[model samples]
Target: MNLTQSEIDLDLGAVTMSCTTDEVATVFAGLLREMRSAAPFIRPDERDALRQIMSHESGALTAGEVFPDFARGSDAHTTLRKLRTAQFIRPAGRDCWDTGEHIEIRPFARIVWDRLGEAGVFGDPPELEEDDIDLALPGADEPVEVALPAPAKARGTRSGAKWDEGDVLDFLNDEDTQG
Candidate 1:
């Protein structure tokens, strides 16, 4: 198949949507306002514990291991219970817990980390140098000539040889064709 720059007709105008930063902020604010007022709140300590678990190579640890400050009886249980109720962490096996339902926390955290980078939380995103934007797109007026290989021939049962009625019977009787 051959195609040119001008031959490709796309309805990008209808498909594309754009908004100003202020408009995006306003919409996000409205969404936040619309959320339930009594949503569960995660404490800073719980966040720290989650980060600790995520930082661990296996993402599994005892509450005591995560929060050495607190004794492992009631206080640690309380914290783990709260996080479990919030569906953040759960029991891994005996004497240990992990992010609930064996969910991978690091990949999800990496996505958020990338979004934070894009939001300029770490620092201003690196400015694109001239070399980065030097590639030129072909204009619609310019001809884009493409040479495509001829369409492939229809294949047959024996490599490229088409089978007749006798050939089918011979193929079925041949021991080489048996499974």
Candidate 2:
């Protein structure tokens, strides 16, 4: 039997699955839960630091690079160290580091996060049919017919202007025509 939502096709490396949009959102919710349980808690300051790194022009930078004003052993420095210990930031090179998988999953996580406050998995409920809608607005009297203005005529040309190759050649050969 048909359902409210159509089946969405999913392509895995070797296996494929078809599910509705609601099902996909539900799966993402499950993933979010598992990821949160496995990952360490990120404090507000640490989140700000991560935001700086993510918005960095180079896409990768050292903790010192991110918070240059914060000296070693300072609170901000300690925050960076905590992020490192949590593996939220991974070393990119000798000194440069970048966001880890947790940050990478943010795009998908955001969708789930938004849905947390919603009643459904995602998207608004299906719209009610006009016949099914019982409530009427204040202006729900006889339908008012509107008269739209006629389309404006094309500019820079006469209403019935038509030109051929001969007309073009004549125009080009006119004395007033510049080289």
Choose the strongest candidate by lDDT: 2
Which 10 residues in a row give candidate 2 its minimum summed lDDT?
Answer: 147-156
For model 2, state the Cα shift of residue 62 in Å. 5.5
Candidate 2 per-residue C-alpha lDDT over 67-165 given as tens digits, one digit per residue, 9 for 90 to 100: 666565677666665655543344445443332312221344335444442223223356689779758787887666532212212223333345545
lDDT of 2: 0.51
> What is the lDDT of every predicted structure here?
0.46, 0.51
Off by over 4 Å in 1: 1-40, 69-73, 94-179
In candidate 2, the residue pairs with backbone N, CA or C atoms under 3 Å apart (3 or more residues apart, or in different chains) clash, namely none
* TM-score between model 2 and native: 0.32
